[model samples]
Target: MCDVGETTWLDATAQAELVRRGEVSPAELAEQAIARIETVNPKLDAVIRTRFDEARLEAAGDLPDGPFRGVPILLKDLGCTVAGETTAFGIGPLRDVAFPFTSYLAEHFRAAGFVPLGRTNVPELGTTVTTEPKSFPPARNPWNPDHSTGGSSGGSAAAVAAGLVPVAHANDGGGSIRIPASECGLVGLKPTRGRVSQGPLIGEAWAGSTIDGAVTRTVRDAAGILDVIGKPMPGDPYYAPPLPRPLVQEVGADPGRLRIGWLDRPGLEGYLDDPECRAAVAGAARLLESLGHHVEESAPAAMYDQEIIGHFNTIIAADTEATMRAFELLIGRPIGEDEIEPRNVAYRRAGKDLGAVAYLQSRSWLEAWARRMADWWTGHDLLLTPTVGAPPPELGWFTAAGPEEEGVRIISFIPYTAQFNMTGQPAISLPLHWTPGGLPVGVQLVAAYGREDLLVRVASQLEQAAPWSDRHPPIHA
Candidate 1:
């Protein structure tokens, strides 16, 4: 019998290789994953729902010989609905309602032979940047249980970081995937908008500001899973330009000497980067230059436009209102303040009151600015920055004690990541540094739209230059 504890740290690809060699059976893998979740979840609260019995049954049965066959995976609770499973989306009303059909994303995961072990936690409606959902226990960071696992993919990142699974589903709209990956010390890639479908539910999320991907311990696992899940199903509003070749192949491929730009400044005028966070990006830039890449201190002036934050916030609020209204129709009742978080109620109200013309103006403003932002990439293939404006915050830092407090905390922390979401570019967060206190600090790399291949090649190169897979948090399975 394979030692379950020994297998915890292998990337999904390596685990799959073991299964291929018959060194371990899929059932054995599933059992080990379940064991890890049972042991670690009590402390981390990363996985909020479980399908252990179903996972065991699926693993014991004939499964697809897919690249990651029978690997146990957790789906973030907000998106990617699995049939017969309750997709709570971190809201109170939907917790008990099982989706009638599995979403296309979940179906793709199943087709790739990833057994669904459970759904992870998220902030209510994924509206905030920390995972202290009123609907479930907060997803604690494995690095330090007292610090937050960034949201709304916080649970997925925590599970992956804690070794509950090698890789887990995560999506990003306003940096959900990258934020948690930064805090939890994992590789998170938010593929170009439309690189993966959001179908059998909606055409796109947050008006194409969001995309789906995963958080993993290795760059290879991140790239490999993208190859598995990054397909456009029929009826997608638009698809990202297809990759020249498989993303997995891009890993370990020669990226050659490339021009890279670096930004250590926060986009928000009054905001500042912590010394440790600033050093992480500077250090990554120096490393890039050492590796023969041209490095420069530059960023788009458009990114600093004071109005950009308001525009993105308005759009997000509008989308939230639309989602909530749709939910009201489904349940045939209005959601009360007691039924939802207070901050969201305010957002919904603001969105409901937004004039349609003003909403269109915000969208138009973003589109025009995106053109200006693209010009910066002309002489550079990549832009590097601290993944977040600061390191992971202690738990309750973004508490919903009051609406003003929550908004300020969010603005103070996530100033660096929302720009790419508005531009529909591919961005990834790599755990490249750790603070003196032992918390992880991530360095981000952003590439032009439809240029995930470049991001993958360069990220894998960096991964080899500074390996992080061996680094584990104190609270591992």
Candidate 2:
């Protein structure tokens, strides 16, 4: 039998291979992961809930014969709901509420043979970039427990980086996946909008800016998992352009000489000009140039439009209000202000006060802004930038002053990632640089809509050129 300690560090793809080779049984894998979570989760508070008994039973029973059979995975508390499990979405009132049916994405994860051990933590309703919710213990960064783990996928990223699990389910609306990946030192891919369905319950989230993806330690794991879940489901409102082949096939494939634009400065005014972040992008540009790609300093003009912040907030306010209503329907009562976070309470009020015309105006304005942003891709195969405007901040950084101050902090931290969510483009965050303080600073590579193939190819090249798989956080198993 393989050492469980060594197995804990293996990526999801490798763990599945071990199961296939008969070197490890599914039950053994489950037990190892459960032990790691039990040992490590107290320090990080990453796993908010556990289903260890159910996981063990599933691992011992007949399992699906899929690409990732026997691999244990964590689901984010916000979405990707499984029947009979609580998806509290980091809200205090809804903490015990369980959904009756599984979401299509969760079904895909199970069909692809990932056993769900538990759900990770998230900010209330995933409203903010950092994952410090009042409802649960904040997810501490594995690299430095004092710093924040970016969210609402922060819990999953922390768990993965800490080696509690190889990979975990993460969805992005505005940098949730990539932000956490950047902070926790993992690979986070935000697939093109509609690439993964939110069906049978949700058609769109945050005005179609949200999409499901995962954070992993390897590019191939990201590609392989995307292949398993990035399929069109019935009743999906829309679908991304189809892939020519499975994404996993693109790993290590040559992404012929391509023109890439890089940005080191903040995309929006009032955002940070952090030295570490700028250095991360500059370093990635130099690396890309060395790898035979044409790299130049450039970015979309639309990124500077200050209107984006307000419009994005408008959509979020509306969605936050709607989400609260949805929860009320589920729990059969009106949620009081005290039960919700202050920021979300303000959002709900703003959404309730917003007239239909004003809401439509914000949506229409963003639609036009997306078109302007997409034009940059006409001349460039990729855009490279810092995943977050700064490295991970200390815990409570976002909430120290209150929601109003938190808004400014959020914009400063995440100016680069939310735009792609609006434009429906596929973007990835790679842990290409580490700060002098030993914090991870991720550089993002964005492809045109539905061009994950290109992103995967170049990411694999970068991964091979600068391998990060061996780099583990201080809080590792």
Candidate 3:
């Protein structure tokens, strides 16, 4: 067998190329990824469970001939359930509950020729923005062991950042994908809502604000993976506007001169106005200008209105309650307050008490607010801002206090990502800047609804302009 160590830092696309060239077999790639996880996951606590034996079997057998054939990847613990595998959703009591069927997205991942190595850690119910569930140890940032790897996809981000896997399943509801990507220094693309299916189980998550994608070291992997999994599935409630062509084709395509607006601060009150965060956006703005895109300081007026926080929370509360009830059906028992995190417990209570009229009011308000937010994109091709309001916070910062206080802390850090989720728009987080202390800070570029094609094109251009592929965290494999 070839020495698999050489493939450690290769992106998913390059790894697949090696397999296509007969330089390495599928089993070899799977074994190498398993080894890397064994070596690095202990330090990061990124991976929670393993299906290594199954992966080995799959690798040695006939596999689909797809772009990422034989490349190994991970699934987040929260969603993307695999048949008969543990679907813990990062709660302690549900750790051993096995899903009877696979999710559509999980099937798509396999069809794309990727091997599922294991499952990554996540926040409880994926409710918060940090992955410090009471069920398991926190997924530490590879860049700095004491810092967070933003949540609910934090474990996937950590694994990818540390070279455990080139790409891993990640989903975003309220910045779950982008925030972790920013914290862990990987490329995170949250596709337009309905771009990916969450079917054969549920149609929408977090009132249609959540969507599945992936975190990768390069823009091409992000695009390639999306191409593999972003197809419309049977029973899907809705679908994003069809891409003109495969997303991978958009990579390196000229985006042409486009107008891009940028914001340097968290426009909402009570949210952090972090200097490093602002500087990251400013640096990205300058880089876009240097690449010939017209950049200016502007943002949607609706984004600043604090009313969004309450309306969004209303939806989250109701969803959290509904998710708990669904889990009761799945596990054959109701989850107690002590069995989950306090924040989620609070959400459950609020949701249970929320009247139907109140829930609809919040949803209607946000829907209208989304239209106001989308108006900015009519005159501009992109809206750029810091992916998060600050650098990766030290672990426990968000949960050090009561749940109410934790909610405030989370809002303070993530002011920019959730709104796009509500609007069903596509946004990407690119690791373009690093703090003087060497932590990665990502900047977000958002496009109008169904404009992931535009996002892919410009992201590819930025990838070429400011290459971050060679950078590795100190704790990487």
Candidate 4:
């Protein structure tokens, strides 16, 4: 077999090319991936379960001639369920809840010939942006073990960053995909709301704030994977506007000159991204300018209002409560307080206290704000910001003594990402800068709703201008 260490660093597309050329068999690829996971997953804690034998079995059997035939990937231990596989959602109460059928995304992955060897770790119910689940040890940043791999896609990000796999499933609901991508120095794309189906189970998540995606080391890998899975499944509540052409075609395509806005602050009072993080965005602005894009200083004024922030959080909390209740009904018993994390218990209480009318009002407010936010894009094609408020934090940095504290800490570290999630727009995080301390700092690029084609074009341009794929973490395979 080819050197597992060297092959592991290749993107999924490159690996698939090798399989197509007969340079390696799918079984060999799976074995290499499994070996790498066994080697590094102990230190990273990125994977929470295993199906190595199943992966080998599939690799040896008849496989579809899909683009990604034989690529081994990990499904984040969130909502991307596989039938009969445990989907804990990173909570104590749901640990034993194996899904009865595969989710739409899982089926798409299988059809694309991806062998899911296991599920990665996640925070409880994906409520937080860090992947510290009470059900298992937190997934560590492969760059630095003591630091966080941003959640709830932390495990997926960690695995990709550490070279355990070239790509893994991740979903964004309030920055779950981008935060970890930024923290782990991988390419993270949060597709426009409804870009990918979340169906056969639920039409929408958090009122359409949640969207499925993947973490990858190369821009083309991100685009290629999106091409495979972004199709609108039957019964989807809605779908994003169709792409004019294949996403892969946009990867190296010229974006032409574009107007871009750079917003260093998240518009919160007394809040600023770390100096390094701010510099990262500034550097990206300079890069875009160098590439002929018109970069200016601007942001949507609607993002600063206190009332809007309150309404946003209200919707999220209400969704959490509703999800818990749904699961309670499924199992025929209410989840006990001791069965959940303390902070989530408090979130449930807050959600329960909000009247249904208030919840609907909150959602209505968000939709109105989304319209206003979209209007801001009239003068700009993209907005640039720091992926997170700060670099990946040291473990325990965001620990809270109470739910109130948890709420405060949540927004403090992750201020820029959720706003786009609320707007159902497309945004991406690219690893363009690294701190002097050697941690990765990502710069975010956001485009109008249903403008992933534009995002992909620009992201591919940036990826070429400042390549980060070869910059492996200290703990990589």
CA RMSD of all predictions = 1.1, 0.8, 0.9, 1.2
List TM-scores for all candidates, in order.
0.98, 0.99, 0.99, 0.98
Provide the global lDDT of candidate 2 against the true structure.
Answer: 0.92
In the range 1-477, model 2's lDDT, one tens digit per residue, is 777777987999999999999999889999999999999999999999999999999999999999999999999998898888899999998889888889999989999999999999899999898888988889999999999999889999999999999999999999999999999999999999999999879999988999999999999999999999998988899999999999999999999999999888875468888899989988888899999999998889888797888898999999889889989999999999998889999999999998889899999999999999999999999999999888899999998968789888888888789999999999999999999989999999999999999999999999999999899889888
- Candidate 1 displacement at residue 23 in angstroms: 1.1
Score residue 187 of candidate 2 by CA lDDT: 98
Tens digits of per-residue lDDT for model 4 on 385-470? 99999999888766644666766788788778998998999999999999998999898999998899999999999999998877
Q: Write one digit per residue (lDDT tens) for candidate 3, span 246-361.
A: 99999999999999999988765788888999889888898999999899999999987878888999999999899889889988988889888889888999999999999999
RMSD of 2: 0.8
Pairs of colliding residues, candidate 2: none
**lDDT (0 to 1) per candidate:** 0.89, 0.92, 0.92, 0.89
